[model samples]
Every structure is written in C-alpha cells, then in structure tokens.
Target: MKLLTCLKQIPDRDTRYEINAAGTGIKTSDLTFEISECDEYSLEESLKLREEHGGEVAILTLGPQRAEKSIRKGLAMGADRAILVRDDEGKVTTPHAVAKVLAEVLKEEEYDLILTGTQSDDWSYAQTGVLLAELLGLPHATIVMEIRADPAQKKVKALREMESGWFQWVELPMPAVLTIQAGISQIRYASLKGIMQAKKKEIRNVELSDLNVDLSSIPEIEVLKVYFPVVEKKAEILQGSTAEVVEQLVEKLKKEAKVL
Candidate 1:
C-alpha cells in the first residue's frame, strides 16, 4: 500500500496575531508556524498504517519555504518522503483551490489511500478532503474516527462519526480519501535520532505553475479583512438578599443576555 497524507502548517494557536497593513491577512513576519493540530493525528495514523501494511508513507503540503519545518516534522514521525506544492504567492488560500491543486498533483501518483485532517486550524474549512475526492473521482468518507485496513482485500473499513455520539462503519475500496477527526490517536514525538534522520529524507518542491494547472479553473475566495475576536469586559453586582440576587440573575439571563 502506498499512502499519502496531506499536512498543513498553520500559525500556532497561542501566537499573538496582528492584522496586516493591507488588512487582507495577518502579519506574517514574527508569527510562529506549526503543523495543524489535527494534521498531526492524520500523519500519525498514516504512519501506523504503513507500519502494519508494509508500505511507503509520503506527505503533501502546500505553503511557502517556511512550511518545510512542518514537513520535516512529518518525516521525523516516519513519513518516507514529502511533496511540497510551493505557493509563495499564497494563491492557494481557499479550500477550493487547495483541493484543485492536490487533485491535479495526485493524478500522476498511484496511492492506495489518501488521508487528511477533517479541518484546518487556520481556516477551519472542513471541505478539502471531500472536495479532493470529488475532483479525483474517488470514493471518500469524512469525520473518520477509526480505520481498519485489509491489504489482501485492498479495502479499508472506516468508522465515521455522526451527530450526537453516533458512528457508522463504512467499507471503502482502495484508492480512496478519508478526512480524519482529531483524537484518533496519540501523536508521537520526534526523537533526536529521528529528527537527525529526517534531514536525510527527500522533500520535492514543485511550483504551482509547473503542474499545468488551468488558471481559468482556479476559483478566487477573497478575504476582505482579518482580525481577532473583540474582547469586552463588564461586571454587575446584585446587592441584595440571596433570593433577590437570584431573581436579578434570572432577569439578566432572560432580558440582558437573552440566553435563557
């Protein structure tokens, strides 16, 4: 089985962000980037599959040169190699564009399975994997919490999550895509030796233009502005007997907050 996992580098959740002067995106100069949290789980699951099935695991990431750090992390975690779709212009910003690029790239590669996080931390767009499946004309399942593969049968049984703690088992043929949910497994840390070895792994960089991608087909999803959630503070005191304070709280919930 040849497995491919799509990973993304995103700004660390704790990093302080400032809107750029253009206001179209955040300031990138001093921002810290790391693998999207959920992608780590995807990468780990792909590595585990390779360990059991005896195959090569490769990663695909789309970003600028800075994204190589995250790619190396995947290599240290046991991916055989990586393919980077270099996008210095940041043109591949939307999930639509990402899926288009990945589909085009994967068209030339042969893989038994493709895995990706259910959503990206930065964009929270939970559509890439499914969209890629559509573009590639492959069967797919999303929100996959568990995966069981049968090499002889050339298929995988996926446990998919549903609303209100429900799950369904789906058997998909080989050459499929799955969007993995978080908490699928405990992600392994990179050992010093593995980190050193990762330096020797191959990372192939491909410019977006080299793919012969149709410029007319790429859709544009513009971001008009980027800003953090506004933080507001307010305090109220109900100075009265316990019963009266309770009444005030109820009133506040029903009227002021309207959350009742």
Candidate 2:
C-alpha cells in the first residue's frame, strides 16, 4: 500500500503573533515554523502503517522554501520521500490552488490511502483535505481517531471522533481520504540516524503555474485580519465576612454588569 500523508508547516503554536504593518496578517520575519501539531498525528499514523503492513509513506506539503525543514522532519520520522510545493516573496497560498496542483501530482502516482490532519494550527480552515478529496472524487472522512487496515480486502476501518466523546466506525475502500484528529495516539520522535538518513531521501519540487490551473477559477472565499483579543481585569478585596462578600458580589454583578 502506498500511503500519501499531507502535512503543513505553520507558525509554532506558542509563537508570539504580532500584526503586520498592513494589519492584514501576522509578522513573519521573527517567526519559527514547524509542522502543525495536529498534522503530526497523520504523519505518525502513516509511518506506523508502513512499519506494520510494509508499504511506503510519502509526505506532501506546500509552502515557502523554508518549509522544506518541516518535510525533512517527516522524512526522518519514517516517510519514504517528500514533495515540496513552494512560493516565495511571502505571498499567502490558497487551499484551492494547492488542491489543483495536488490533483495533478496524484494523476501520476497511484496511492492506496491519503491521510491529513483534522485542522491546521494557523488557518483552522479544515477545508483543504476535504477539498482534495472532492477534486479526486474519493470518499473521505475527517476527525479520524483510529485506523485499522485489512490488506487482504484492501479496506480500511477507522474510528472517527465527534463531539461529546462520540466515535463512529467507518469503512473505506483502498483509495480514500482521511483527515486525522489530534490525540489519536502518541507521536514518535526522530532519532540521530534517521535524521541523517532523511538527507538522502528524494524531495520533489513543483510549481502552481505548471499544473494547468485556471486562474479564473480561484477566488478568495474569506479574508484574514489579525487582531488582539480585548482583555481587561479588575480585582477588589472583600472587607467583610464570606457571606457578606458574596452578597456584595451579587449586587455588583446585578447593578454594574447586569449579568446576574
């Protein structure tokens, strides 16, 4: 089985984000990028499948040239190879445009299964993988928590995560898409030897313009603007007994904020 895992490089989860001078997006110069935390689950699961079932795992990502670092991390973790789709000059890449190029790449490689993260840390759009599934005309399910493969039947049984601790078992054929959820399982780390081996693996580069993508079809579905959350804090010391302070607090809530 050939498993294709889609990964993304996003700003570190704990990185401080400051709006750009244009107020359109966050400042990028001081940011350190890494693989989206949720995406790690997809990569780890794919690697495990390869180790257990004996197949290949490929990591595919689209971002600026620096994103190659994120791809190399996946390679060290156990992916057979990587694909890098790059755009420089700090221009934001759209998901639909990425799916277009991915469709072209998929045409040449026959994959048994495709896995992706449930959502990205940066955009949280949760649309790209599903969009890719649509473009490929393949059955897909998002928020998958567990995966079980049956090689003989060429089928996959996955446990999907939903609201309120709910889970549903789903069956998918060989060629299908799965967007994996965070906390599906623990992620493995890259060792020193694997890190050295990653340098020797192949990483193919591709351009958006070379994919026969029609510019007219791509349009902005949403606009992004970064803003700081409004925050205010006030503290008052209680000067009376516990019951008296509780009474005073209720009065303050009713009269000041009217939220009681």
Winning candidate number (TM-score): 1
What is the per-residue lDDT of model 1 for residues 23-133, given as tens digits with 9 covering 90 to 100?
888888888899998789999999899889899999999999999999999999899999999998887888888999988889888899999999988879798999999
Q: Candidate 2 — which pairs collide? A: none
lDDT of 2: 0.85
lDDT of 2 by residue, 1-260 (tens): 78999999998889788989988778888989999987889999998888878889998887889989999999999899998866664443667766776776788787888999988998788888898999999998889999998867989998988789789999988789999999989999999999999999999997755666674677655556668888664677666999999999999899987998
User: Which run of 10 residues does model 2 get worst, by summed lDDT?
Assistant: 85-94
TM-score of each: 0.88, 0.87
Name the top lDDT candidate: 1
Off by over 4 Å in 2: 90-92, 232-260
